[model samples]
Every structure is written in structure tokens, then in C-alpha cells.
Target: MPPLSTAATPPPALRQIGAWIAGLRRADIPEPVATVVSGCIADTLGVALAGARASAGRLVAADARDTYADGPATLLAGGRLCPEGAAFANVAAAHALDFDDNCYAGFVHGSAVVVPAALAAVEAAGGSGSDLLTAVTAGTEAQYVLADAVGNGVYHAGWWTTALFGAVGAAAAAAKAGGLTEAATADALAFALCGTGGLRACFGTDAKPLLAAQAAAGGVRATRLAARGLEVPHGVIEDPRGFARLMAAGAFDGQVPATLGRYWRLLDPGIDTKAYPVCLSAHAALDAVRDLMAEERLSEADIATVRCRVPPVVAANLTYDRPVTPAEARFSLPFAVACAMRYGTLGLEHLDEAVLADPSLGAAMGRVAMAADPGWNDDPERARRAPEGAEVTVVTLRGDSFTRFCAMPRGSAARPLAAAEHAAKFRACAVLAADRVPGPAEADRLYGRLRSLDRLPTLDGLLTP
Candidate 1:
């Protein structure tokens, strides 16, 4: 980067995004958008509390402690490290269970990366709560905007968009938190995109969340590099060999969302806060199965076969007919349907290794036949109760078949979880890490701080006294 704005090095599209990140403010953000963002922050922290105990979280926290040594940022779940290291650990923990807030338009886990990255950046600079909140909104906007800027080919092609666009978002948030101008922010964005790209194959492994963690750390590091006046290509996003061309293979045509700031992407085609712990591809199927089982009062023994109709893309992800591990089961539609039929629901409780290892689960998995349903979107929220999204046809031992269509899974924009429900989830997550997390009293205080974030002075109260 030549320092200051490089003239015409990047196409107008990338520069346009840069200007917006430079100008984002708590005042400019609409009330509804800010409110939604607060919920996202609370939800992400809730998930991270639980994730901190997961293998990915524990392993990364150890690395941050051993390698990072001393720093100014807290990991939220526990421990402290350098800002980037904290972000790496925190983001990984947030995504440990794949339950973080999601953006359907971008098809990425937005909150997992944004919250961790922004929190680390803000706390490191001793920034105010408004600064932290603003950083998150800017970061989310950048992620989705870049996701939209790049054609959907990368996602439909099965490359993880969260890892790809999320890095750029992380960089934007860090740049803002670090008080960079437009030129430095652009350079940071350029640096961040260099680390973009991850695989869907890592979905069930510890590697999946680590990929997200890497992106988070990469964002913070990119901003630091920019602030130190390190040199990166200016406006490399739309260059011949830049991010858009290199990442999209020339499919990206420089088109931008018409309403970048006029309307928050968080609201329109909104974020799908997951109700189920499984992959979003299978949430609709799981919802359908649970509803049918509850209505007919069917027992596991009574369930003969479940024919699940999803889009072809959805079926490709839920390929594990009889998953042998908890990770595999998390992506298995057959497994989700089986669990729903067996327990009348699927949740964190049913996703444990002990539950997955049961021999009886294999039989339940066999009875679920997942096929592609045309004329329907993969996302349940778009189903709009039109009976076109995901349908479950269950056959019982009595040879009677009961069918039902799920419009959308709960916790979606169409039927968002209330603030109390969101708090309930936070409490549940805190309970999982009770040994490390604050007690009920302190946790509630922290939550209240987030809800009225604009009034808080600094992020010192995010997790600590």
C-alpha cells in the first residue's frame, strides 16, 4: 500500500465499500439495525461461552496462552492474549457448535467472526461500547457486501463463504476500531482478502471452527500491518490478479447491492438465527420431523420411514445417512430426522458422542430417505409457509403415512426469537461453562450492558469486572 488512498488501483466497486467502512457510525445506523446487532453480540457471546469448553476452543486458547504470552485482550470465555490471538480463540469458540447468527444472502456465519474480531479490536484500543458496536455493524456489512460483490459461484461450489468473506469483514472492523482513515482501511481490506478461502469438508472437524478463528485473527493482524504503514497493493480487490478475479475466477462482474447503507442487509433477507444445533441445511428437515412426531404422538418404534424432501444442494450436505461421529451427525439430515423421531426433537443434548454412538440410532438413520425437492428454496425462511420448502412424509409401523411442510424453522427472521428467548439461550450457554463464566447476577449485568451498549463508556465490562 502506498499509504493514503491509492488512485484507481482498485475498481470503483471495492473503493465504494471502503468509503462506507470509513463513514460508519452509531448515529447513522438505524435503530432496528442497532437493536438487531445487540442481539447478535449477545448471542455470539453466549455461544462462545459454551464453545470455550469445546476441543477447538480449548486447543486454541492454549496456543494463545503459550504463544501469545502477554496482551491486552480477554477471550470472553476466559484467558487473555494479544488482540489477534484473542480474536482467533474467541471466534473459534463462538463457532464451535455452528449455532452462531447467520446471513442467508451471504450464506456465512457473520456473528462468530464479527463479534470476536470487533471485541478484540475495541478492547485492545480501549475504545467505547459505541465504537465496539459500530465496528461489528461495519464488519457485518462488509462481509455481506463482499459476499454479494462476489458472485454466488463460490458458495454453490461448496467453498465456505464464512471463512472467505468473513476475513475481509474482520479486517474492516479492526480498521475502524484502530481509527484508520479510508486509505488505511482499504489497504487493510486488501491484506485481509489474501487469507480468504476455506473448505466445506472441514464442517464436522475441529478444523472448521479453526478456519473461522484464523480469519478473525487475520483481520486484526491485517489492520495492524496497515496501521504500521506496511505496504500492500492498493485497491487490489478488483485488479486483474486481485481478490475478486482471483477468488471468483472472473465470474464477479463488479455489481454492488443497490442498498448498501440505505437498508441494513441484517434486516432484509435477514440473519437466520438457528434454533437447531445441526447444519442449517438440515434444520428445515429437523423441524418438519419434530412437528409431525409431536402431532401424531409417534414413538420411535412407530416410525417406519421418513421421506425428507430438500433442495439438491441441501441433500449434498446431509449425505451422512448413518453418521458414526458427533461431527458427522451434525451435518447428517438422516441423523437429524432420526433424532427428531426418536426424541421428538434435536438439540445440543442429542448431539453428544454417547448419543451418536448408540446402535439404535443407526436403525433410525436408515428409515430417513432424503430426496431433492424442486420448486423450493433451500432456506426455510423463504418457504413463507407455501408448502414448498421442506416436507416430511413419515410412514409408521401401521403403514400409515403422515406428511407435513415446514414453512421456516423457529429463530428465523420470519419468526425471530424474542429478547427473553435470546437471553434464555445466553443463560443456557453460560450454564454450560458455569465454572468459567460469570454467575447469574454478573452475567445479567453484562447482558444489560450489551443491550444499552451506546451508553457504556468502554468495553471493560464485556466479560470482566
Candidate 2:
């Protein structure tokens, strides 16, 4: 193995990566990339609007008021906050329900991190809509690169890669939008490293949203600090005591920078949009459960036991081995699979406390079991098959059994939700917000405006009370 010191040298490719992102003019960005960025933006906005009423979102919004800035930026919720605060609040809201787009390369929520940072930067800098889209694309691409470099090392080490690597990507995006030089962008990234942290243990709690929020704020702070001439180690990312080495517990791979733009991580691997709001790892099991339910036409009462075979990686993150609360159920693979089997679908309504507390659902959830498939984890080829796929088996009281396997969860990049389904999801999320905000007509209009965010001249006009 190479010495850790060997990793400290800044690869020549780093400068080239920085330059490529900085050099992208609005018109220079590909139209497909721009359109995808728009879709991500719209999806994020819908999540934010829905999350604004969530408990975590409200708390984050309140804390953000302390950092208030009288700017053109629109906070996802009703109030106005500073650029950093707005980014934090919006990102938190966007990720509150865990319904944002995920990048396969890094397994991070790309839109939640990039969209918040770009929107804040554009609003604060008085930038154009095209600038916002370009910055978002660049930021998302940067995140995927960093995530791919780390591989699954961070996850194996129990770090939430999204919050860890997301700070760097968010900082890069903000720095680009802020017109920072290559040196400045590197410095901003260094500053961001100081704020990086998140654990999978915090998944079911309000801390889940806080993870993304802190990353968003840290990104903005990094750029602002760099703009003021703050100094940071140029080789922070590659340094032994720095991000990659400290977080991944290994020497930096020389191949990371070489792959930066040679392959567009965003377009190549692309984004995975969640059909169900539960953990992405649980999606496959959910799909399998739903399949068995349909194939056997079994009612919840007829089932004796439900078992799911899943990858060890999924098993590791299913913190709620047996969940008692609605929040806990969201992270429990067993509970999610059971809910899918009994209810036939896992919708937002199913996550409600009342639904979780239902005796019938509780009984069904208790009957579900999850076991790790050593084959799935041991075989490198099979492990790469699908991050969220699983095999489900159901045993009935009549001594009959039903089984189903899912290679990819619904709404994944491989099996995307159609336009109508995406619209329905947005409408459902909008309804979550409409319940709190007055005037149903105004709320519907706001939803329409959010769907057309790319055309909006100013985000300020969208936040009317």
C-alpha cells in the first residue's frame, strides 16, 4: 500500500476539474443537463414546500431567522432568511421526507444539496436563471465524482456519505456561482470539511433533515469565508489528515480526478427518484412485499410470517429491527415490507402516526422478518446488481408460500416514474403544505408556479404570504 503522504500531492487533474466547472457558461451547458436540472429543482421545491410544515422544518426555519438577510432569496417556507439560512432551511425541508433524487455514483441526494446551494447563490448574487441551472449541474456532478471516489468505504465505516461528501459539492457549486478562482474554490472546500459530519444512527430522528441542512449552510459559509481571503490547505481533500483519508480510512485513489468530466456522473449513472418515501435501501423489500401480496392475493390476517432476503448493507442500516413509532417504522425494513404486504402500497398516508398505530398494521408488522443474504454481500457482481433490490418470501397459514424478487425498486433510474406519477407526487406534497397555509386557491397557484421554477425571474415573488 502507498504511504498516506503519497496521497497528499494535488493531482494535476484537480485544477482541470475546477477549471471545467468554472468555465461552463450558461449557453455552454448541454440542453439535456439543463432540463434535468430543472426537473430536479422542481422536485426539490415540491419537497421543500411539503416539509416546511414538518416539525424539523419548523425548527430549522426558526433557527434560520437568527441569520436573516434582507435579500431576494426565497426560503422554502414562508419566512425570509439569509442566503446560508435559506439554503439550510430549504435543503432541510427538501430532504425532510427523504423523497429527493439520489445519485447512483455517490448514493447521495444530489438535488437537495445542489439545488439549495445554487438557488441561494443565484438569489443572493442577482444571477440569471440559466446561471442557477448551470451551477446546480456543476455542483451535482462534483458530488457524484467525490462520492464515487470514496466508494462504499464511508458507508462501511458508518458515515452518512451525503452529509460528508455533500458539503464539498455544495461548496464547489456555491464557489462557482460566487465567481471564485480555482484557488478560492479549493479554499472553500477546505472550509467545508470543517463542518462535515452525519451518522446513519440519526436516520429516524429530526437529525436526518439537519444533516442536509448543515451541509448546505457549510457550503455557503465556505464560499463566503473564501471570498474574504480565508486560507485553507490546497491539498485538503488528498491530505492524510484531511477529508478522504480521515473519513474513508485509506489513501486517496489516483483515479478519482481522472474520471471527473471524462464521464458525466450525473448523466451516465443518473438520478434515482424514490417512489416510496421510506429509506432507499428498503425500497426493494417493499417492492417484493407488494408483489407477493398481489400474486398470492393474501390478506394480512391469512399470513403467518413474512421474510425478506436483503443485502447486508441494507440490513446494517435498518436501525429499527422492530419499530414502535411511525418515525421508527420509516427506517425499519421489516416494518416497511410488512406495511407493503398488508396495505399493498406505502404512501405518505401510510407513514402517518395513526396508520402506524393501527392494531392490524401493528400485528402485520410484527410478523415480518428480515435476514441478511451472505450471497448478496459476498458476490461482488450480485452486490452491484441493485442497491435496493431484495427477495421476499411469504408463508401463509394454509402451508402455502409465495415469493417475489425485485432487481430495481420502482421510480429508480432504471424504472422511472412517468410524468403523471411525478405530477401526482408533487400534488400530494403540495397538499401537505396546503393544510397549513390559508387559501386553497393560492396554494394551488403556488404549486403551479413551483412546477415552472426555471422560468421565474425572481424567487422573491413566489414567497408571497
**Per-prediction TM-score, please?**
0.92, 0.91
Model 2, residue 295: displacement in angstroms?
2.9
The local distance difference test score of each candidate is 0.79, 0.76
User: Which residue pairs collide, candidate 1?
Assistant: 1-231, 1-232
Which prediction has the highest TM-score against the true structure? 1
The per-residue C-alpha lDDT of model 1 at residue 317 equals 68
Candidate 2 minimal-lDDT segment of 10 residues: 1-10
Backbone clash count for every predicted candidate, in the order shown:
2, 0
Candidate 1: give its CA RMSD in angstroms. 4.3
Candidate 1 lDDT, tens digit per residue, 256-322? 5334687577886677787777788888778887887788888889988999877666876666777
